[model samples]
Target: MSTITYYLDMQRPEQIIGKPLPADLSVVECQHKQYQLNRFLYQLVGEPWQWTDKLSWSDAQWRALIEQPGHRTWVAYYQGAVAGYYELLRDAEGVVEILYFGLAEAFFGQGFGGPLLTQALQSAWAWPGTTRVWVHTCSLDHPSALANYQARGLRIYREEVEAEAP
Candidate 1:
């Protein structure tokens, strides 16, 4: 199989289109490092999309990745239930990368992706010294993934196709 990966970036905060969260939905940062919760979320939101890179991550690996100084996670709650999540990491040069972003299987098609992504971008830009915010999505992701990113003002910076084992 061939997987197409698109790299997107926002050079300024004003670039974001800004979608407001619905009255019944809210996004909050996971202030404390919790590898277990992060692992669960990674599995929960990424299973259908073939997100296997972190599936084999040991507890210490997960902790080291998430417990770093510039890493952050945000979760979206729909009426108090876990709806979706995104993770952001800022590099030394002030670039914040949205490492992972997705909604749960149950939350699809309910108009959550846009607003959730907006919040993610806002959070990314809000980080101190942020010069750029970026993310990558592949063809394996939800069909709306690329559209949502573009609609939110992230411009394509690069694209590549890779062979994947079936």
Candidate 2:
């Protein structure tokens, strides 16, 4: 595959502000902050896989996430429609949080997640009283996710490398 380079700014998620893709790929704001968090948690809590299950969502659920503070949502438009989404939130402690992030597979390897993540980290590094930055991922359920986290320079502070499903 040829080299694909995508650009995104750390201070402004709006810079990318791609229009929602019209095809199967599209990004949208979460109905609620909790639902927004759930988007990142597909593997966790036994939620249906966005990629495998056609990724259907309820509009009512999305509206609630939009009302919360410290929650930011933006959809990726592929071919003029929303294809994927990235969310960023901050806790009372002032640590920049990667609350939930998802992208249509078509957008991967084209330079989306990496820059968005890098910018999130950059935002965290720039924040005051932020001593450390981190993200939570599993080694077994989602192997690629762990690799991606490492690639983003997030250290593994906790590990359950062999947690058998209950």
Compare the candidates by lDDT and give the number of the best one.
Answer: 1
Per-residue lDDT tens digits of candidate 2, residues 1-166? 2222122112322222232223444444554456544444433322323233314656565545545675565555657844455566666765556655555555555555555555455555555655445555443223355555556656555443343455
- In angstroms, give how far residue 144 of model 1 lies from its true place: 0.4
- What does candidate 1's lDDT look like per residue over 1-166, in tens digits? 8989999999999999988999999888999889899999999999999889989989999999999999999999998889999999999999999999999999999999999999999999888899999999989899999999999999999999998877
Error (Å) of candidate 1 at residue 72 is 0.4
What's the C-alpha lDDT at position 117 in model 1? 96
Q: Which ten residues in a row have the lowest lDDT in candidate 1?
A: 26-35
Listing every candidate in turn, what is its Cα RMSD in Å to the true structure after a full C-alpha superposition? 1.2, 9.7
For model 1, the local distance difference test gives 0.95
After the best TM-score superposition of candidate 2, give how far the Cα of residue 95 lies from its true spot, in angstroms. Answer: 1.9
TM-score for candidate 1: 0.97
| Alpha carbon deviation, residue 156, candidate 2 (Å) | 1.0
TM-score of each: 0.97, 0.52
**Which parts of model 2 are misplaced by more than 4 Å?**
1-65, 123-132, 140-142
